[model samples]
Target: MENVAILVDGAFFIKRALHIFGKLTPDELASKLCSYSEKHLARDRKGERNKLYRIFFYDCPPLQNKVFHPYHQQQIDMAKSERSIWRLQFHDELRKKRKMALRLGRIDDINVTWRINYDKIKKLCSGRLKWHDLKEEDFSMDVKQKGVDMRIGIDITSLALKKQVTQIVLISGDSDFVPAAKFARREGIDFILDPMWAPIKEDLYEHIDGLRSTFPKPCNKKKLESSY
Candidate 1:
């Protein structure tokens, strides 16, 4: 049986989950992630499953500091913020899951700043909205994630060199993993990319053994619910 190692880009997964799975609690989100990873283990026609070596999840911890919000005209304590709490709880849930490795990076808080929302900036550029008309929702904290891609690359190289798994499934939409994917394929590992229905770059097609997405489409929420 093929031994599979699933690597997840946590931020990408969370953003896509909001669009595909809708709103779910942190615990529910973590459980759904595990369930999603299990789908990769399914083999052809006969009801067979592959051996799961492990799930490596890469993400940066939420920023934990007080930053002034220009739109809100107040200081926001990110450490006690809703997103921070949710992320911490989600990480904890992942830790309790079996055969899961939570690999965390760090936030570049020193260079952190509030960025104007894309839509708001577009409106301003098109003369549809004025600068003074921007509301609190028009701005969001820009937290730069550092070390995540590096950590992912390191883990993939380690797994391939150590012969820990015969297959590697990366669930991310970014093209940053091309080098790692190429290396894994050269090592005789079946590298697969699961963008979860998101479109990937055309150049990415040549570096992987196969492309497969093992989740319900956004339009098929009912099927996803039934699976659980």
Candidate 2:
């Protein structure tokens, strides 16, 4: 049986899981995640599944301090925020899982600011946009995940070179891992990407061995309720 390393992008999973499973608390998400990993990402080509070498979950600690969201014109207090509290609890939940390695990255909050997309701003000025005008993505908080990408790259390289596992499955939509994926495949690792049904860049197709999403797309509220 091929040994698999399940690497998850915590932020990506959290945001998407909320859409899939309505109102998922951190504790609930952790339970669902473990079940999902075992069922989906840990399988070999012959359809026989094995326990993971380690489930590597990468995320930064939640901001426990207060910060300002300039566009929303409000002081977001992480210390008192429900989401922040949930995130920290979520990390604890992951930590307690056997063979689950929670790889942490640092969050940079020093110069966080609201950054408006220039293209969107220009369109608004020229009256060419309406559907997405005033949307949240049009203006985003420019906070950086300082070491997440670097850590992921290093881990992938180390795993490949050390022959840590025969199969490497990364659950991320970020194309930044293309290089790492390519390198892993070159080292004769079965590199798979589980974008969790998210759309990825066209170029990312070339680097990975295969695409396999464990989670099917979540149905609408009515369909979900009817199934039950």
Candidate 3:
């Protein structure tokens, strides 16, 4: 009797699903996730009652202030609205500062180049081009309101330490979780990595007991019907 616990990174899962399936209604996304979990459990021989311990959903809410492109907003809204699962947990304001830093660096380069080129292009046309209002405050980086990684790390570590679950399933592709996976393996738990719709890294697979991509299966029609 193996007890399995699933830890899902909501933001990562939603983004990957959107990229893979195109636009999906909230119900559609939830159905896909439910199907994914069930299939994994079946494959692991733990789909039966009492064998599956619990599924822990971990994710930070979207940056409320940052303007999400319309399509992204739809997906984000749908994920937050899902509240049917008892094990689901919400962690808000989890910011990805490193990714943000990299984006800001690229924006700075674009700004410098635009400053040099914009005036020249305008002069050639004998006209002035007005730059859109830009502000440093718009690019400021701060702590994520949700702190997803911290929450996820804590849950994985605590569960592994307590030996509550014989197997752990992580539904994320972020390399930030390598340490947690390693720790789980050291504690003799079978760590499985399932990047629902994302690419699985070879290095990540090396640290886990197995790797499974959950994007090929059909989504749960029942859940999709409810999302709308």
Estimate TM-scores for all models. Answer: 0.92, 0.81, 0.58
CA lDDT for candidate 3: 0.57
Best lDDT goes to which candidate? 1
Q: Residue 148 of candidate 3: its Cα lDDT?
A: 67
Q: Could you say which candidate leads in TM-score?
A: 1
Please write out the lDDT profile of model 1 over residues 36-84, one tens digit for every residue: 8998997845656799999999998888889888887888898888878
Kindly list the per-residue Cα lDDT of model 3 for residues 63-115, writing each as its tens digit. Answer: 32322223222323223343313112212211211111000001111111112
lDDT (tens digit, per residue) of candidate 2 on 123-228: 8788998644476546655557778888889989999999988888898899989888889999999988888887899888889989988876876553121010
- lDDT of model 1 at position 184: 92
Reference-based lDDT, residue 116, model 3: 28
User: Model 2: runs farther than 4 Å from truth?
Assistant: 41-48, 71-76, 115-140, 220-228
Given candidate 2, what's the lDDT at residue 93? 91
- Give candidate 3 misplaced runs (Cα > 4 Å): 43-50, 65-146, 217-228
Which scores higher on lDDT, 1 or 3?
Answer: 1
Ranking by lDDT: 1, 2, 3
Candidate 1: the clashing residue pairs are: none
